[model samples]
Target: MPHFTTTDGTELYYTDQGEGQPVLLSHGWPLSSDAWQVEVKLLADNGYRAIAHDRRGHGRSAKTYTGNDMDTYAKDLAELVKHLDLTNLVVIGHSTGGGEVVRYAAQHGVGRVAKVITVGAVPPQMVKTDSNPDGLPIEVFDGIRAGVLKDASQFYRDLTEAFFGANRDGSNVSQGAKDDFWRQGMLVNLAAAYDCIKAFSETDFTEDLKSLDVPIFLAHGDDDQIVPIGAAAIRSAELVKDGTLKVYPGAPHGIHGDYQSELGKDILAFISK
Candidate 1:
């Protein structure tokens, strides 16, 4: 198992494959790098070196009760990028991973990064504070914490429906896709999953969003039930220095899987330009 030791000495697992411009992917909450398998293959096929990692406490990485917050998550990624010595990289993050990339780019600067994409990402903050009065309420996250504590397996199962827009009438539901999501969610440490609920929900990314100096692509689904398009993705594109927004009609939060082919084409086109 290929791995890198974080600054705190935690062994983190990652997969590096193909060859060309480095494209690093970050997975969503309670999920692993397995979530990016389809996109990885597509990127590699399109002539880009694709890399993805399981966040500490998720997938094959060590499960720790502490250091499960966003800062540590960003730092762990920073170390991985440095270890690989990757340059002119394009970082794509989905859901919680989107928040991670924003913070990482801000903290580390664009010395190595060429572009960034946040798909159905939680950024510019998720939880409502005095400044972010329009953000999601704490009760929404509290419910998630409760679900993880009481019954994570079933909670994850329910998440797939909510995440993929399966709850919507006339929506196409794929059992295999739901199963894949459950499998990835189960691979993560329950404690880490629980802690990340707060990490992703509360962390403020205002400073991070304001610091970007490279092109940022904010792609999101208009019908995302998990993270509203207006509050997150739409608002995020507006904050970045040079950001572009692309919203898919009738697509769900997992746009990477729902519209993999089209999304890959768009990404390849962006990277080529």
Candidate 2:
């Protein structure tokens, strides 16, 4: 029930737990902070203060039909950081949240930030443009928007399979895991989910990546179907001044959840060092 008001007067919800150096987690599109349940437990048990938030119009936050862009999303996080007065924090973002972390660091400045990590993140830009020919086409995102608008529940169900690499042969997909993903997606507002399609797809994080001074850990799955690892993750690592890239073979976009133990180990080691 803890909430903070953004500069735009919209109330955003967040969960702050444990005590130690802070680790702020920003989740992907159509999902809420609930995505970090596993990571949060690991961090908390290992002596780190963990914070996770529902982005505006997602989860328990205000669900408006507009203002679901990356700039506003980043600003909403900024307000939450300021409210907590956290310092020396580590920000970890997945998928669209990775774009948020990049923009937040570039725009707001990581005055108190020590490091950042982006997993299967959309950055530098996801949609193919005249400048970035390697990016995904706009129609792909358009399909997502159309699908979610037409049938949100079914869209989320299908998304879960693709996200966790369950659609692939020999892939281990849990029904419970897929159900949890659907539950989170269902909790979000359809309008927010629809608008966020454009937000994550079109927002270019090139300048943001070039501007960040903090150390960054970029991890992606070579088999990611949602956000191709080569196009987004690999390219983003090249842009960061102090960035390291790690690719997991046969992993999917939801590598954070699919390979939580391994990813958590990598994150813990990075933060400890």
Candidate 3:
């Protein structure tokens, strides 16, 4: 297993494959880099270098009690990029990873970046506030925290249904995908996973999204149960300096899985442009 030590000495596991324009990937909350397997393979096979790292406290990375917030998460990504010495990069993030990418560019600068893409991402804001009436309520996130504390395993299992739109009529999500989702969710440390609820929900990425000088592609499933399109992708596009928004009808938050082929083609096409 390949790993890199961050400034705080946390070892984060990552994978690098293929060649050509570098494409850095970031996974969602409670998921390791394994969640990006399909995208990694697609990018690599298509002649782009695909790189993904497990966020600290998730997957094979150190599960610390602290530093589970967005600022630290972005710093870790910056460390990984510095370690690899990559430039003219395309950074793609999913869900919580999307917020990380935006913060990374805002905090670390985008001199090395060529483009940014976020899929089923959480940005601008996810939690409801005075200015953001479209966001989800804090009670929803509280319910999630309660679920994680009471029975993390069952929480993940139940979440898999909504996460992949398994509960929808005419849905055909495979059992393997649900099982894999559960497996990935269980790999994170309990404390870190708990902390991440606040990180992803409360951390405002409004200023971060506005700061990007590079072109940003915002892709979201209109039917995403986790992060709604109107509050997340749509709002984010408006905030970004140079943004393009693509909505996938009838797709779920796990668009990278169910809509893999379509999402892959869109991603490749975006990068090419």
Top TM-score model: 3
Residue 63 C-alpha lDDT in model 1? 89
| Index of the highest-lDDT prediction | 3
Error of 3 at 111 (Å): 0.8
Candidate 3 positional error at 98, Å: 0.3
Task: List the RMSD of every prediction in angstroms.
Answer: 1.1, 1.1, 0.9
lDDT of 1 by residue, 31-130 (tens): 9998899889888987899999999999989987889999999999999999999899999999999999989888984699999988899998888889
Q: Which residue pairs show collisions in model 1? A: none
Report clash pairs, candidate 3: none
Q: State model 3's lDDT.
A: 0.92
Ten-residue stretch with the least lDDT total in model 2: 253-262
TM-score of each: 0.97, 0.97, 0.98
For residues 148-229, write the lDDT of model 3, one tens digit per residue: 9999999999998899999999888899988998999999999999999999999999999888999999999999999999
> Which portions of model 1 miss their true places by more than 4 Å?
256-258
lDDT of each: 0.89, 0.89, 0.92
lDDT of 2: 0.89
